[model samples]
Target: MRTIYKKELARIFKDKKMVFSVFLLPVLIMVGIMALVGNLTSRQMEDIENHESIVYMMNEPESFTAFLDASDLHMDVKSVETEAERDDVMSMLKEGDADLFIEFPENFDSLIQGYRQGDEVPQIKTYYNPSEDYSSSAYELISNQSLEAYRQVLLSQRVTDMNELQVFTVNSDNKDMVVQDDQKASGKALGMMLPYFITILLFAGAMGIGTDMIAGEKERGTMASLLVTPVKRKSIVLGKVFALMTISGISSVIYIVVMGATFPKILGGDSGLDLEITPEQIVMIGVLLVAIAFLYSAIVILLSVFARDLKEASTYITPAYMVVLVIGMMTMFTTREAGMKDYLIPFYNTALALKGILTSEVTMAQYGVTLAMTLVLGGILTAVIAKAFESEKVMNL
Candidate 1:
């Protein structure tokens, strides 16, 4: 078994294309794509921040104007009179010269105070060209700010003293009790995405090597030669599966390290995510990754053994990869914690377990269930592949 394992490893590593596909391709692609996306996002944010929004206001309130003026947004505010002039402002917006047109109703301040006191509120009209980027951005900023300012005014009138509010008085002392610190929150956010990334890498890394191991060799007439040697068929199957698992595991680790180092920079430096994964959690993650890799490699090996050539194996494996990806995506969008029944599923259990581990939400029961299921599935597939190895027809194919 050891000799066959060593031989398989050596043969796989010797193929430069296979080595690159298994080890370096995922990292390079992840880094390159993340850097590009991050750069574009950073530029868009800078543009939004530095943009000088041209705003036209009709009967604008002094309070709202004061709020905008006190802020650091680069805005060019102009006051206009009469409905006809407001029409001209709308024309400017449509023509792309101005970013926004806001109109406050007559007696705006008195009406707002009245509305806060249970009277009907007057609607404020805002116009901006949705097709224009600057206009849309300006409208979003101005509308949010205006609404917040109005909310503050209403709250001030209703709650003269926050200390006297019953809700505040009760909850003030317990504010820190339920608060998740920056690090934990960051871990949760990263957890949401990391599972999907790792799952895909594991399957992909295993697919290339697993297909080439049996299918490629069979196509090249090398598999028969290796089979006729003085080696046990079970050993041959074990050796190739072990080699595939090793390569897949290595690729997954590289992907994790690369994503960990680069995801923050891509999201922007000030994102304030603290991804301090604990040692225990790291161990859990490592175990989960190994289980998932083993399961995926075993499945790939089964497909490869059944295939007559690399193309046939890839054709059979592509849909399996897609199924895994779709399952991973479903796990990514999951808002709730994993239930007991969730661990009963195979590929999906790995994704949920990964999420739980990263977010520090996994239970011992869940971990045990996922690991057990994965091992059972892997063992079953390995047995099937070993049986196939002893079949003359399968070997001849």
Candidate 2:
């Protein structure tokens, strides 16, 4: 078994194309795509922040106008009083001449004061073209400034202490009681992403090398030569399965490293992701990852053994890849961690377990069950592959 494993590893390493496909491609693709997205996001944010917006106000309140005049926002403000003038401004906004339009109620300040005293609250209408970036930016800027300005006004009238009315207040006494406060948000973000990426990488890495291992050899007439040797058929199957698992595991690890390094930069350092994964958590994640890779490799090996050639193997495996991807996506939409019974499902369990690991939500029992089921399935698949290897017709096919 050791000799067959070493031979399989040597054969795989000797093929430069296989090594690149299984390892380098996933890393390069992930890094390149993330860098591009990060650059685009930064540029868009800069554009939104720096660009001057033109705003049209209908029946503008004197206090609001004074508030805008006091702020540092770069805006070209136009005030219209008559209905005809308001229509003209609306036309200008529609024609892209103006970025945003704000229509205040007839007696804006008086209405707000009245509403505070138990009268009907008047609504402020904002208009912007959703199809235009400048319009959207203008709306965002104006709405934020207006909300803050109004909040301050209300606070001044009602509250004695400004600190008591602040939106976010820190309770320093219980701060340390929050579990992994610094990493909680970042972990959830990573949980939503990494599971899908790792799942896909496992399947993709297996697809390329696993197909070529058995189906390619069958097509090239080299598999028969191996079968006729003194080696046991089960050892050959075990050796090939081990080789596939190694390559797939290597590719997945590369992907995890690249994503972990790039994701913070991708989010522009604003995402407070403190990737402080504990050594124990790392071991748990590594164990779960290896188990899933073993299961995926076995599935691919079975498909490749049944296939006549690489092309047929790929045709069969593509749908399996899609199924894995769909299952991984389930983690993103799921609001909570897996229950006990969920650990029994194959790809879904892997995804749920990964999510649990990332968000620090997994229990010891859930992890143990997931790992056990995956290994059991992998063992069953390996036995089936070994049985098929013993059949002359199946081996030839």
Candidate 3:
């Protein structure tokens, strides 16, 4: 078994092109692509922040200008008084020269003191251009912050003493009110994403190597020679599977490490991509990764062995790969808490386990169930592979 393993490793290491494609290429591509994405996103955000929004307020009160002066909001605020002026502003907005067009009610002051005004956008292009970032930002700022603030200000006039109305408070200034665990908070943010990536990447990495290792070798007529060798067929199978797992595992590790280092950049600064994994959690993750890799390798190699050539193997693998990818993506949007039964599913369970591990939420029973299900499935597949190896009819074809 050791000799067969060494032989398999030697075959891969001897070929520089294979080594590069299997390992170094993915590293360079992931880094370059993620860095470029990060740079463009940051630059886009900076441009939006620095932009001087051209705002046209139709029927704006004089006091609104005074309110803007007292606040931190800055924009090229303009008034649209007549129909001709409003039409000109609308043209400018469509042409992307103007950022906002806010229409205040004719009875603005009367409606300010708790009146039930119309709260609908008139099914026209009056609020802001959804296509333009500047327009959207300006609209959000004015509607969410400035308008809300001014409404509160108007309400303040009704109260003789603001403190007297405040029998109780909401979100008080005391630090205890905002108490939170940064680690858990970070975990909550990352838990949705990391599992999907881990599951998808593990299968992807294994597929690249496993397909070529089994089906490609068969195409080259190397599989027949290996079968005819003095070494036991089971040893040959173990040797090949282990080699595939090792190479794919290394690829997964590289992916995770590079992704971790570049994650903050990918989301553009203080995006809270940090993970607070304990040593024990790290061990659990490592164990889960191993089991997942093993299951993926078993699935791929089994399909590879069943096929006649690389093309056939790929034909079999692609649908399986798509199923895994879809499941991984499903995990990201999974809002409800997963039960032990959810963790007992094959590919999905591993993803959930990974998510649970990161969020520090998986129960012991769920974790153990995931591990057992994965390992048992892998063992069953390995046994099937051995049976296929023993069959001359299957091997010859």
- Candidate 3 Cα misplacement greater than 4 A, ranges: 69-72, 81-97, 106-126, 152-168, 261-269
lDDT of 1 by residue, 170-237 (tens): 56567577766777688778877887788777888788878988999999999989988999999999
Best by TM-score: 3
Q: Clashing residue pairs, candidate 2? A: none
lDDT of 3 at 292: 79
Winner by TM-score between candidate 2 and candidate 1: 2
After superposing candidate 1, which stretches have Cα over 4 Å from the reference?
Answer: 14-21, 56-73, 76-98, 104-122, 129-133, 146-178
Give TM-scores for every candidate, taking all chains together and pairing residue i with residue i.
0.80, 0.82, 0.84
Residue 222, model 1, lDDT:
90
- The digit string of per-residue lDDT tens for model 3 on 120-154 reads 42221246777999998988887677887976686
Ranking by TM-score: 3, 2, 1
Judged by whole-model lDDT over C-alpha atoms, candidate 1 comes out at 0.84
Whole-model lDDT for model 3 versus the true structure?
0.80
Candidate 2 regions exceeding 4 Å error are 15-18, 61-63, 79-98, 105-123, 129-133, 147-180, 265-268
